[model samples]
Target: MDLGVKVDNLPAEAMMELAPRVEAAGLDEFWLIEDLGLAGGFTQVAAALERTRRVRVGLGIAPAAVRNVAYLAMEVATLARLHPGRFLMGVGHGMPEWLSQVGAHPASLMAALEEVTVALRRLLDGEQVAFHGSHVHLDRVRLAHPPAVPPPVSLGVRGPKGLDLARRIANGTILAEGSALDYIGDIASAAKGLDHRLTVFTWLSVDSDGDTARARLRDTIAEALVHPAMSVQLRSWYKADLTDAAIDALAVAGTPQDCAAALRRLADAGADAVILQPVRGAESAQIASLAEDIRPLLDAG
Candidate 1:
């Protein structure tokens, strides 16, 4: 089973220990959230690269509004050169508030993403693109320090339109773990000939106190739980409520056995790998238990 962690991407001191430990756990990748709440995505990747060798580090969907493709392409090229096969970039329609904070909201998300993606590729392939698209008009857009071999690009999208875009353009997609593989069936089939990596994030907990675990997770991931895409889909499938508190309460709030069952469900949903997010404020005992005590169950598939 391919496993990874959803790290806070803050506190450089934390990565020194966490990075090596995650690598030691034999996880396949480390996906970093832009701790715009704390630091930039590039800084997090740099810190992680310095600590681990084999485990890949993903700048997991840095805020699209915060970065232009030109700046992002350069940083990605630099990281690939520095870390070789150890870095990937995931970009997407970011937090709504964060986009407003930057004073830019390109009306057509699909067009904005498409333009940036095309321009970034042209630059990375060692070509200067004089591309003028509605969202981004590039005249002298080019990369001088492009890597000999560029890093792979990933996108995060939930709807069919975005999924189709990922299928058409990106190497893969990075996602917060979600179930309902059937929801995006045609999108994945569209990805048949290409190598589109699916990295799903799930907040996992395993303990006897199912109520406490669920409560803690409710508080930690409340915002995400009620996100439009997540809640809308959940409500369609189950009796899951769409309100913030209710959906949050539903996020991975169960016993280790229960959480394991859920992961199995998601894997069967067509996830290639799952990045487990441990519940917030969990004790060392809990962390240790999750890491050492829980044996792998059968493949969810």
Candidate 2:
């Protein structure tokens, strides 16, 4: 399995700086999130790709409801042509409340996400697409300059139905942070007969002392456990009370050996790539440890 990191919750300017650091650290991929008001995923991806030569850059997700499929395909094609195999695209249904606030929520979230993903992939593959689904409509649209090597398109979603949709249409699936081993294993089991790739995001914090590293993630884990979407998935996967002890299964935290073990467990559960999302205040240090410390342990293991 490959290892990667996400530029989560960091200031927009950090992308330029972090991109090089991720590459220099010998990580395989660097990912960017497209939150409601954050830096645009496509723009950040373009900038990061321009700044780095080797590391693959991914848009962990761009909401399907907001962007028009044809135009989105153009943006994707432009980046793919420039970066080729170095770009990975992920699209999904936006958060319900956030989408509603922006008036971009579709009546049928599943249909909208499915339609957008299908159309986008077809366009990127240099095929003329005429798709008319619940939320996406295109009239024989095609990209004039499709990349010779089309980038993989993953779907960022959680839930059985959404996972099924991803397996049917996308090249891979992106699981959100707080995805536990059981959840990943179940998803992997379901995809056992296929070639679907799994990219998992998990909160990360590291210290020489295992307890200290886990302590740093206490508040963050608590906050994540309360999220509507994450809570449902986590609660279903974990029967025990949600506490610091649960951190080992839910996140990559603790000493280098502990973090390495946690990551290896995720990889064993069938994650193709585990993307570390650092704790808010300790982004740089956590990443440095991931490269200088945890990575070597994983390699040796």
**TM-scores of all candidate predictions against the true structure:** 0.83, 0.96
- The sequence of per-residue lDDT tens digits that candidate 1 reaches over residues 71-135 is 87888888888988889788886766666676766777778887787777778888888887777
Off by over 4 Å in 2: 235-242
**What is the lDDT, from 0 to 100, of the residue 170 in candidate 1?**
81
- Tell me the tens digit of each residue's lDDT in model 2 across 1-301: 9899997666778767889999999999999989987898888999999999999999989999999999999999999999878999999888888899999989989989988988898998999999888898889898999999888999998988999999999999999988878889999988898888999999888999989888888877777766776754586534455566788878998889989999889989999999998878677788889999999998898
Candidate 1: where is the Cα deviation over 4 Å?
Answer: 9-12, 177-181, 184-190, 208-211, 220-229, 235-253, 283-290, 298-301
User: What overall lDDT, based on C-alpha atoms, would model 2 receive against the true structure?
Assistant: 0.88
User: RMSD (Cα, Å) of candidate 2?
Assistant: 1.4
Residue 103 in candidate 1 has what lDDT?
74
Number of the top candidate by lDDT? 2
